[model samples]
Target: MPIDHFHKFLTSAQQEEITLEAAHARLTHFAGRPWLFFPEFSAYVTSFVNAMRNPVAVAPVDASLPLSQYFIKSSHNTYLTGNQFSSKSSIDAYILPLLAGCRSVEIDVLDYKNEPYVYHGYTFTSRIPFKLVLQVIRKYAFVTSDFPLTLSLETHCKAPQQIKMAQYMRDVLGELLVTESLDAEVMDLPSPEQLSRRILIKNKAAAAHDPNSTRPLPDAERHHSAQSSSDGTNSSMPEAKGGPSSSILSKKVKFVSDLAQLNVYHQGSRLPKLPRSSDSPDLGPFQPHFDQIFSLPENKLASYQNDFDRLVRITSTNIIRTFPKYTRVFSGNYNPLSFWAVGSQMVALNYQSFDFHTQMNQALFHPGNRAGYLLKPD
Candidate 1:
């Protein structure tokens, strides 16, 4: 390489004048060029070569801290490869992110015949079989990092298919799926080291009235009626009515025991309303359960920020995930730093898009052993 080109790659401090003798000596020492042995230039070249080195040292990640205290690298719409509205959903989408050290991924599942399929529901995106997605996840989940992987499941499947979804996850993932807490008696959640090499399902738990049964609750019947009117038909598997980005709105959907049991640690729930007054005496009602996780939309983050103390209180004990807004059809990503600044653990980004925000996401997780989890600053 030419001296000028080599100088361009060095830091400013290393870009000082280089004598021909020093240059030849440095090249000979590092590259070992055969021509450097020529007698004509032997006298000018010296054995010693001064080289530049990185000044900053990377510290080892402390994985023993509570899981809620770290900012986890996460991906949104993990099955979409391109535009959100019309992209082809493939298992490779899951593989790419998992291998890139993404610890959390979203899986939107709906019923297809007797089986469950993964896709962006109510969109033109093609679908992949639920079982196949699980298999792919099992194969590549721990390739880059052994930290726990959280599967944020958005299930719109009926009873029978919901059972199959659970069965497939149990069968394919095997012991990797966390069926129960490692230390149930502990007050705080388990650490990443304790849950290493395991997968946690983040989904809504079944209603308490019939936790072990698939019977539809009263709310489910109301949702069925509303869904029938919206679709103008009595479809057994009613389509969820709303914008594509809206969450699984049907609280009435009955969850089978098999599927609900998989939500051992991270139970998905709606974000509760923040207290209007900062000096409000009671935060007990606003606080989320220890095992609960709130999936707040990007736009809603500002509202939470207004009550910064409450947000911190909620996040200190439980996990908070913030995803992209609904209108980002081009797969653009929002600045994740704002979410991270407010102590949100999982600031999920569209991994398929290499936008500025996504690049920042990559840079942030590149340190701390790239273990997909970094302890937040105090």
Candidate 2:
């Protein structure tokens, strides 16, 4: 390096060090931990702090790789601001996650007043007009991020209602709706680059029943759900559409094919119902109980060595979503690291909570770059 260039580099390094030190002071000042800082620390901490500001790339991330090979920030039950029972729901719920750079947000849709509503089904959780939620999504979808966003839809709508949802989604999302040719590769999910500023729906289209219909939300949980809905029309557990627990998968509604076509880029499932193939949709990192039931005792990721290895291998080539347990009625989240350790791409957290899980999520995605997708380890 030339002498002048070397001097300039030193000056730049010093400036960066000053900036980081000031940031440290500001953080501690707010935290009321000024005693934690000392003058001597600056000499040694500058190099380390500067390195942290520019972390080494964990994996090669560009336009070539498929979408499955990435860790994505995600949120579960995105609408409910409170507990499962008497909590409130709002369009702002959609805004919160999207603003925080969540690549995927879930919306529980049901037929209400001949139109679609978004909320927790069979529970007292509040309901917001689906169109209202769509508006929030449309406005905030690309503001914080230009990468693709997936809406995890759990539908309990009739045929006409489903069509209404389709039309409304198209209208609200407008040009952001990805109709076709989202991925460059034929056999894989598209890279984030391919679907920038696009929104993809994820659902088992035509499902008329709610999965937890038989198991009503307990009174406490129902109360929260009901409180979320201002009108309190569904204060009591609404009579389930289907009598038996034949499961939502079997309850076929109208517009199944139409809705499926709209979900071109992504699809969500609670289990590996479809065969293991490139065409198969992304199966869930199901809630603990659901995972235990579907994955089996020895096949569970943490309990079985082979299963953990299998998760890593599968996620390397396929997109997988792991969500928190449904029993967490308090809007709590799961330890995201465990899921990430198994190569889970979308460790869906309850963004409403400020728990350990949320902290981890912030740290992982804190690096500036509005791209919502994070490259998973190779």
Candidate 3:
């Protein structure tokens, strides 16, 4: 038989095995026979031997679905069952229902300096270290067999504390740690440098009002530098225009400009660490005293003053429209019980929260929909 036909027959045969010894005898017997003209059966036999010696393991990627549906809100107490490190059974009992619906879990971690613990406040009564909780989770939590379930870790430690304890656990167990909490009003990512610059600008503006800080410029009055054009609008808003001498009064105007920029934010940023008094009316717009800064051409001064006035008006309008959302969430005047009750009902209904979790999940799994969320400055 041709080698091709014989190979095909071997493949088609069911439960038929030719031992190595028997196969070698058959090959030897066939060798040098006139009917078999094959010269390189050795290579074929070697290929077969290698194929039989080593086989690869194949796993299907499509066998599983993502566990994104499972999530935990950090405000309330929630726990996972049968976590490798968590040994608690009762906490897992409370967490079982949430686990069935979701693949990830969350818990709040407050710092306990020397030990792996969880707590809040200055009192010992509030302490609940993570070490104790994980011990129970590992004991009773039923982790998904195929997919690694994530523990959504949240830290409530103060900003200055650089304790590496939690980071250590996150590294070893490969869980997600959410260090920053989203505020009622969304703000840009915290950058210490940006914060410092803003503080410096505010300080400089305050210092300009001090006689001892810097001498008043010698020439506060000067001829109008900005000439009125056919349109009659001062073009100096974006650049230096006819005001007091650009050299002398420019520094003072710039200082005021920096102060105005720093104070441009809504109540929260502008205020000196206090809630707005209920009786006080909103300041309508920024009012920079142009008369102090410049003696401009009549038409040009009006135009420049109007530009400054309009910018403040627009900014305040934006704040008035958007600042309420944050006030509701952050004002602490909210009744916690009422908020909790509503949230509980929504969770019972499996209603998705339109904010953080939804956005975060979308960002992680559905990258295409990621975008920004902004609210007026608080």
Candidate 4:
């Protein structure tokens, strides 16, 4: 019961979880139920903590399947460290997640000072210089693990800035950026092993119509092809996007044209229905404002159980990303295990907060050497 020993134990706990062997040895003097006096420094590390540290068993992960075959860790508004709006955007948004082994990170790229910046659009969110953010990413892209990083950018920049976005990425990322998979003709996603240490960009492709075509492609036609979860490769570069909405579409066209020439791998776009289980490149679902519509996991399980089954089916095969509900104004996070139970891969968590969901996420990826990607159960 010495104060000095307690202080040392606390200090060590801050750096890493204490091992049970260390705890048992330290509390060897205690006759019985050592945890009663020192609950925090229990003689035994709980089974939960042990399981978190080592998740896999005799069944090793199958790495031969395509990249889309597993659950991909993702982030939604990765730049903002605060709420839906009026929050300060910082490089930490990207840092914390990448450090926690999150594979997919989002960037809200906008036009500012004749250069590109990142922030949530239509909100009072503060902007951070796009170059600086990318610089931070380049520096820490592989700090936690040596796996590929997915940049899920939401571009609101003009054509010039869009081109700059591409150029900056090419310069900053260098060979770490992946433009194509080894076998592009297969149409299915490549294995994570195949895309190790690469960076994947997910942004809506530029629409081809002049924004006033008499017979523009319909909503169905725009997304006719099932875009790969890892997304469309040159798989013959199918025509892209939805019916005309605004002049912005045309501007996007100008930029996507530039990207197409560059041979970008994953073209982000609006997907129609949930993709069925497959090895082919199919569009994955990302349902933003999920909690508002369905509330928490319990409510959804009670009211929309059938839909939950559908989710399990979809996620069992493809990676689906469900973001925090807009109602969580204080940057709160949900228990990601519920979604994981249904097989959703990238349950984009609010890593800024250490909520239960974030803890589960950290634990789930904690096993397997923190490589950031985990295979969904068969």
Candidate 5:
């Protein structure tokens, strides 16, 4: 059936309101927890939930909802864009709407001659200076919001200049900056916020550059590659397909410790830190914040179970891979089938607003156009 017809049936059946309530209840259970909204792709899930048979109620998007703030790139045209659509104007428009409720925003920091610059890689030249971007961010930061607009910057390379660029942002944005971990599961993922805080240095290899050296950060076993340069930096050289290091494991442990320290130092109180188990490596990274929030004394056992179950469901590999653009767009006899399955799905949904649809199309169709952000079109 056409999705539009399905939506109409949902509205006509009064099932729409019921499903929204169900979704809201699920969201409330997850309140105060960190959640990511890939603005471009989340609309699909929104539409799915809206069309589902469940009597869940989904709330309209509100900035102040209990969600721990997350960040995304400037690929979407936010309210700040002011209507005219050019690449630069597109980015200029999002600052305010994002600042409205976001606790943190991602900035991709590039190092140019030992200084940090804030433009995404796709817009300007590869070697654009960091100061130039900073000037623009300052000029366009016209957002008015109560909460401080925190920054979560990512460094594109292991280059020493990444560190220096981060320091510059701290100097400017001050305590609102949060240096995101580069070992963010995938390596060298684009982060714009790194321009505003210290870029997270993972292995000894990344540390060798000294863009802005800190207390010797611990080596996390999660090396991009084992091969090291004479300067102790991890080489971009690919590894020969073995597992990560024991020291790297310890480094991850230490990294968690640093995160705790940062929360305490910046956020005032330290969040709960769960003890690492001797049990299983299959359990992956443990988020102490989730543990703390769910463990609150008054929370219902049912609520905890519901949230945990949904969390597991959302984090599954299948759910993430469901994004059409994330999968390779194969070209063959089967290409027609793939296009219908993926491309048509993207075109079928009805968003709450036309602005949202426009922004999403930019992300779905032109992901490679953003600097600092990389989408594998392959």
Candidate 6:
């Protein structure tokens, strides 16, 4: 092969390292060989290769800032092995993404035989024992990254099962589960560095006044109802539509005090409309506090595109999470960049899909040692 052909494959920096004189010397040294195999030429080529001209330094992440300041690599409906409607749910679904550096995972819990089970509600998806899922998460949560793992829990179980769910987490996850705030007086959320290796519960907290009451909490019920209206599938209970599943779906349930109290940093709540201006003195009635997380569907988030500046202001101090639109029944993912561009902290995607959107997600989180958290660019 001509020397020029080999030189063309080299990057500019590589070419400078292997000068013309050096290449000629290398060729002359091999000229007398009886057999000039491709492997020898391949080895010569490989020696001059540089994976990147300017490689990023592999350093520990600066996780001292508030959790809202980082873009968390997240997954939606993480237990499904295939499409959203009827796919088989498996523990491997949780294993794959956690091993791949996903920092947040969604777990939809429903009551089965008076016990908590993990699966998609109002669908034909298979169920996995909730305890088994917790065990699997315990084993794999920090395998790829030790920053923090957020469990986006959607509970549809009564108080008894909700208590069991909390007990299972405590017994199986042990010290990995975060049961209280790192600081009692600090107003801001804890940093990823502070919560390293800890698991966060992102479920709606029951009313402080009555923890174990079966009565629906306004904030929790409103959030799930809005989500149901937007996504077509209720996170807690679906309205009676007259079907075999109607009796089950119509049963309203709330997370018990045991499970609700476990939510420390990421309290899931409905996001109120942003203030019209960044300098507006009055935040809306539903403005999320430091420890609260605003969960929005992709479609709803897109509606705020015209108010980009306000969105940025909101995300700067509060955690905003966006997931794929409910219409994506096949487990298709939305482009996460749209949400990330506006500083949304957790843009959850369907990990089962390997399409362009997911590819972009993998590439974005590939840096910072794949620690599953990246500081938002100012």
All candidates: CA RMSD (Å): 11.1, 13.5, 26.1, 10.8, 16.7, 10.8
| Residue 275, model 3, lDDT | 21
* Root-mean-square deviation of candidate 5: 16.7
Q: What CA RMSD would candidate 4 show? A: 10.8
Full-model lDDT for every candidate: 0.73, 0.59, 0.27, 0.57, 0.28, 0.74
Report the backbone clash tally of model 3.
27
Error of 6 at 64 (Å): 1.0
For 6-79, candidate 4 gives per-residue lDDT tens digits of: 43554575454566556555444331223323322331232222243544543444566755556777766788
Worst 10 residues of 2 by lDDT: 289-298
lDDT tens digits by residue: candidate 2, 265-363: 453322322224453333333211110111111123344333555556566665666666546778787677877787777777776787887877867
Which stretches of model 3 miss by more than 4 angstroms?
1-76, 79-101, 119-126, 138-145, 158-162, 167-378
Q: What pairs collide in candidate 4? A: 67-190, 188-279, 188-280, 203-268, 204-268, 227-282, 228-231, 228-281, 228-282
Residue pairs with backbone overlap in model 6? none
C-alpha displacement of 193 in model 4, angstroms?
0.5
Which sections of candidate 6 miss by over 4 Å? Answer: 1-56, 207-251, 275-286
Candidate number with the higher lDDT (3 or 4): 4
- Over 168-188, each residue of candidate 6 has an lDDT whose tens digit, in order, gives 999999999998778888978
Q: Give the C-alpha lDDT of model 5.
A: 0.28
Per-residue alpha-carbon lDDT of candidate 5 for residues 99-134, written as tens digits (9 for 90 to 100): 222223334444445565543333332333554444
Error at 249, model 1, angstroms: 6.3
Per-prediction TM-score: 0.76, 0.65, 0.24, 0.66, 0.33, 0.75
Root-mean-square deviation of candidate 2:
13.5
TM-score of 4: 0.66
